[model samples]
Target chain A: MDILESIKVALEGIWVNKLRSALTMLGIIIGVAAVIAVVTIGQGGRAAILSSLESMGTNLFVVYPSSRNATTPITRQDLITLEDVEAIKNIVPTVKAVAPTSYLSIMTQVGRQKEKTTIICTGQDYKSIRNLELVEGRYFTSEENNSRRRVAVINEELAKTYFSGESALGKQVYLMNTPFIVIGVVKNDPSNALGFGGDPPKEATIPFHTGETLFRNLRIQIEGQTYSKEEVQETIDQIVKLLHKRHRNEGKYRGYSLDQEVATANKILGIIALIIGSIAGISLLVGGIGVMNIMLVSVTERTREIGIRMALGARRRDILVQFLIEAVVICLVGGTIGTILGTGGALAVALIAKWPPLITPGTIFIAFFFSASIGIFFGIYPANKAAKLDPIEALRYE
Target chain B: MIKISNLTKVYRTGAISVTALKGINLEVAKGSMVAIMGPSGSGKSTMMNILGCLDRATSGSYIIDGVDVSTLQEKELAKIRNHKIGFVFQTFNLLPRLTALKNVELPMIYAGIPSKERRERALKALDKVGLADRIHHRPNELSGGQRQRVAIARALVNNPAIILADEPTGNLDTRSGEEIMDIFQQLNQEEGVTIIIVTHEREIADHTRRIVHFRDGVIIKDEEVLTPISARTTLAALPPAGEV
Candidate 1:
């Protein structure tokens, strides 16, 4: 029989037992759906993170004191100080801007609104080093950092959460009970998830000297930016060398570019996605087994029909092709439905998570190929069994 | 035409074996109607299966239309069956999901006929069996007599050398049986089709031109009827029944 003819026959068979066919296809549906959903969500998350990392800074690297092993510990003397920052600015021609910053999670309050929030204590150049945009007011000036003025710049998220409808500029907000006036409000950065968890954090920034006075024993980190992307590594090397020389600790400082960190993060995310996807693939294998089981039952149920076809001069190959086509049709239909459902599921997740879903045509093609392979792999035994039946015995079957 | 010499069939069950047909010799001419009648387990069905190329003989030579079917491989036998033989079952084994027209087209499909020609020939065959109006009806929707007629249409759609009917009228009422016998006789006398019917009923065998009686895996009697009964006349004389 022609392939089209066999397909027609298979469709008729499926249509005749609609509920059974649906139940049989449910396994494949769920298997493919899970696989597609995982892949799409993983890709979307990776894209979101990478894009946010890109927006964080350009040609940026962080230089900090390394905690060398216990055999050669890093002392307080090795910490990156304001003098080291000045030395890098003066000595490194590749360096464009540098900011000495400290991150502290503390309780802050504006009138009745009180919450625990992150405080970014940095120099005036923090804005240029981090590419921070100001939605309202302005960043603290060099005068504020030099004189240890009690002033703060709040992010848009903190503005919305703490101040409500009131503008946060020139308002008084307390950090660890030390009152500081809000000098500016910077735009909320979605890429803040790198420091915090996935949720963007509410942040208030203060002058570096003011932070040193307010909180003692601060571990300072020097964030620097290069003139261009190509100069990032060289610039970081110069900055680290300057710090080592100033601190008199030869191997006590490490500098890494933001791009390198992001690459490592991407690798880790890829491994995680692969692990989850393979776990989902186990369901597809189980689904294939389900197809095989149903096909065997169908072959047994249609023994007399097989006999009739054989008596009508159907070759064994024809019989085999018929059943194989039936199985493949079932899986392909299930796979198509799964692609639709999985895409829908990924979109729903992306909607809730505020990320764009990344579903490529290659993902869909791989899904199709896998489902077809499962059908063929599982379909062979039963179809071959049907083909090998003795026509006389099958005809006599009740 | 078919020629059989020293044909035998042995069925094995584990280590035990039962001989079904022993040294049977038979000949059937083209365009002739014949009936093989026997009691249950008398090997008539075995002989029919062998003749239809559904089974191979153990130690015999059976030639159909100049081809030695007994020596043919599975694929070759299937091809010969597709081109040269057709079958009708006792239970009217039409695929339940298909319409009568699709059922008729089954053999032609295996014969690799194109769709348009397959449909055209299937319609013509259904019309020949007086089931043109019911071609769209599934097997369950047709009466026993109409179902048998659909089977006959399927048998003749491929234009095979011979039509094998295994108790074709066994499941039908007497009137329906007469109607089926009428179609068979018409196809035989009018179309010059070779037909063989396997039945135990003496009355059904009397309608054919020749009858071969089997007893204990051997043909005991082979005789030609001087005057064969006419199924059309028999059907016409019966009381009128519901539309089928």
Candidate 2:
């Protein structure tokens, strides 16, 4: 018989046993649904992270001393210092901004409020590079930093606790027995700073030279930016070369860009998506087995029908094709329904989470093909059984 | 035309063996109407199945037209059945899900006839069986006589050379049975198609030109009737249908 005839018969068979066919398809529905939802949602999360990293600035890069593998342990003298930062700024023409970090950990007091916090000391360029806006006074000048003036900038946590709704600018706060005047307050943004970047720090910022002069022992963190994101690599190479020259060719520094971090983050997320997709695929295997089970039962139940068709001059292959087509129709229908449900669920979740769910056509195709293969692979045994039956015996079957 | 020589069939079930048809030789001429009469387990139905190519013989040479069908493969045998043989069962073996027209079109479909020609031929066959108005009726919606007529239409659609019917009137009332017999007689006479009927009723067998009687896997008698009963005449004398 023709393929169209077999398909018609198969469809009719499914329609006759609609409830049973639907029940048999449940496993496939769940399997395809899970794969669709997980992959789309995972893609959404990856996209969200990439955009956030993009907003933070793709031009951003970092360098740290390659301390662990060095032939000799790095000392304070071997670490990045203020002289190295100044030399890099002067030598690397591609460099747009440079900030040398030096910190003094101490307890600070403003009126009756006292808190133990580190005082971050850096240059005026730190404000522009950090993309921070001042809510109160201005940052310290280059001359004030050179003169080692005892001035500071504070975050909102300090302002809320110490000032108690009063203006904190121009107030005196003592750190490590030294009195410092508050100059600027950075605006607090809690929404965008989520996960891993936990609660904002309750700290103050002082001039680099002022903190360096006050504390004999200070840990330094050097941050810099390039003219553009594309110039990051050139600027980094120049920084390492300048640092090597200043530190007598120790070559103990390392640099990274935020773009690289984004790539690594996406790679990790992709692996996680693959792992979850595989876990969901296990249910598909079980679902295929269910199809096989139902197909076998259907074959046994339709023995007499098989006999009739055979007597009507149907070949073994015709009977086989009919049964196989029936199984495939069930799975394909189930897969279609599952795809709709999964896409709807992903969109619903994305709406709630305020992120776009990314579903590619490739993902849908893979899922549909997988469901079809599941049907064919599992349907073969039962179809073969039906095809091999003796027509005389089948006819005699009550 | 059919020729059978030493035709035998043995069925095996694990350690048990049952011989359904003993050694037999028979010849049937083209365009002849014959009836096989026998009681239960008399091998008449077995012979009919072998004639219909539904089962293979253990040892024999059965030739149809010019081909040696006993040596043919399962696929070749199915093709032969599709092209040349038609069957009408006592229960009127019409597919329950199909309309009468679709049922008639079934064998042609298996024969690979195009859908348009199949439809045209099926309609013609149904009209020949006087069921043109009932083409859309399903088997369950048909009376026993009408169901049998649909089966006959199905059998005739492929324009098969031989029609094999097993107890064709076993499930019908007297008038319906007589009506069906008349239709078979009309088909054999007008179409010149060879007809083989398997039945236990001597009254039904008497209508055919030849009667072959079987007993316990063997034919006990094979004889020709000098004057065959004309069922159409008997049907004409009976009261109109649907009467108690």
Clashing pairs for predicted structure model 1, backbone only:
none
Candidate closest to the true structure, highest DockQ: 1
Q: In model 1, where do residues sit more than 4 Å from their true spots? A: A194-199, A351-353, B242-244
What DockQ, on C-alphas, does every prediction get?
0.77, 0.52
Worst 10 residues of 2 chain A by lDDT: A188-197
- In candidate 2 chain B, where is summed lDDT lowest over 10 consecutive residues? B235-244
The residue-by-residue lDDT of candidate 2 on A264-300, one tens digit each, is: 8778888988999889888888888999999999999
lDDT of 1 at A131: 86
Candidate 1 per-residue lDDT over residues B1-244, each given as its tens digit: 8999999999999999999999999999999999999999999999999999999999989999999888889998999889999888889999988999999999988988999999999999999999989999999999999999999999998898999999998999999999899999999999999999999999999999999999899999998988999998887889999775
